[model samples]
Target: MPKDSRQGSTLWSTVLADLRTRLDAGEFTERFPSDRELVAHYGVSRHTVREAVRRLDMIERRPRVGGLVRTPPTVLRRLLDTLTALGVQTSRTTTTGEHHSVEIAGRLDRAPRTLLTVHTAVLRADGGPLICLQICSAASDSVPSELADMLLDGSDRESGQVSVVYEGTVPAAPDPEVCEALGIPTGSVTFCIEARLDLADGAPILQRAYVRPDRYPCILQFSAP
Candidate 1:
């Protein structure tokens, strides 16, 4: 092969590899770049850009319907269930500690002056950090044995509890502590889930979790009426 042609081939292969990495990292979730945009961004010829994207099965190109569209990443129907469906093995580390936060106490329906036991857990999948959870409940002695056990192991054992979950996204930059725990760099985005579990005959348990969507995308399914 000619020297310039060989260099072009190598460059396109490099672009293809980077594109795959960005796709897996959820960078193109909202939009897939145009051939012109990719050419400009990667400083390659339009033919080179097309050659790189042509091999990506996740991108669909249809005539007149739309330009290149990215297929959504596979979603985990529920994270609380065993991660076997996603072929991921998960492990967790829990630390028992005390927290005195008015906000947490209010959520748990405890007195502002009461001391709370916080169970901080960092869940990993296949040795990679997945999520970090902080569960707050009444102090050690007052907490039910079952609830405490569940908290310690990071299990979802709300047999007779009313659970309300609030989810949103937050930038990881401001939360250096959480970024370190989740093994994600600062300036990355994370999904945050806050759950209030109200037991039948006990104070509510407040759980806050930060999840890395790029690593583990999750979706909730609802049936039509």
Candidate 2:
């Protein structure tokens, strides 16, 4: 009689392949099995089970017009709303201060000598850091105070009235300040979303957001039309 002989790395690969097939078949619909359950079901060591599960975490299947397509990191307009919808408890830390800047003034279409109010926020999910956001606007009466208040409190005010000039993700190596804010290591490769939002009145709001994709993976799905 021949004995079943798969072991070690070979066994881990076999288990991973089987898990992928099961995932495609929607076997684990409600929830994924635990390590103990997987080990018992596959008759493999816990180490092998862990190795397979770790790789599975990196796999994201996105549907497209033709077929499944790879997804790139992208910006989420309503960050707090999305997280809450996903049943993740979120919290925010915001700081507002005045800064004298020429570049920010130029972006907001104000005079170069204008003062700016900088609003910085760190959004956390389940007590873990997720996004570091900064907004710059003119520190004058012309700019509506409610806009600043809404941003500071993570309200959706003026969301429908704003137009996005540019919104996308870029590979970034965050500076020491951003690294500390997002709780990521210095020199870590991450995604930064730079967006220029314009109000109906032509007032510009410059927003820069640093996102930790590993902690908060940005997955976008599209259906074929």
Candidate 3:
């Protein structure tokens, strides 16, 4: 029997777990299983299946209708979930860059225990012409010495190592300095994550990522506990 068969909350959690299991098992084959197939396999309504799928997307990205799904990383980075916690109560992320933009300017109240104050940031992501960040210290800071070297040498970095930020209000466009930092052309677009990592000794690690926004949307569903 499954771990939790009880209805409502328990059932929802079970479904979400099972959905992730199937995806990891290659049930989707770089594509989504048909709605009918999913319904039959999960023995649930279309709505329930949709909710389960949505959660998997938030935890791990999936393929678009015709795009290929990227392979999940072998080692799940612990940092991703911790960073996402700041966004749990988010409302109305009204722009192309919603999922990836966080306002580093105002993360003072509930800053993560691992981070010190994020003093300031200019560049926030990789894949741009010049990925630049001048992070200050926290006693336990673990940002590799090599990373600083990598950025200064003009190497293009992925968005994960950094985060993106936006004011609570939407803007006409993402920060151009961020685009330039990420090595993306001024006009080219991508999905990004703006965040503040409480690093070293309560030091704030900030990012301003520019990414293809349509590719990512943090979704959720509810069920029994």
Best by TM-score: 2
Worst 10 residues of 1 by lDDT: 69-78
Look at candidate 2 and tell me the lDDT of residue 214.
89
Tens-place lDDT digits, model 2, residues 1-225 = 111276577877888898888876756554567777776788777788778776775344332211121122225555656776799887777777787889778877789988887777787878898888777778773545455345534443335445567676677997788899888888887677777877677778887788888876676444453
| TM-score for each of the candidates | 0.51, 0.53, 0.30
Candidate rank order under TM-score: 2, 1, 3
Q: For candidate 3, what is the TM-score?
A: 0.30
Over the stretch 1-225, how does candidate 3's per-residue lDDT look in tens digits? 223234655655677787677666766565666546656776767566566666664244333332233433211122233224544321111111112113333453332343332222232222222222333333244444444333322231343443222211112244564455445557555443344444223434443333333323533233453
Please identify which of the two predictions, 2 or 3, would achieve the higher lDDT against the true structure. Answer: 2
Query: What are the Cα lDDT values of the candidates?
Result: 0.65, 0.68, 0.40
**Alpha-carbon runs more than 4 Å astray in model 1:** 1-77, 144-175, 186-188, 217-225
Residue pairs in clash, model 2: none
lDDT (10s digit) by residue, model 1, range 115-151: 8987777888889988777767878435443443464
Q: What does the lDDT come to for candidate 1?
A: 0.65
Model 2 lDDT on a 0 to 1 scale? 0.68
Model 2 CA deviation exceeding 4 Å by range = 1-74, 78-82, 141-161, 219-225
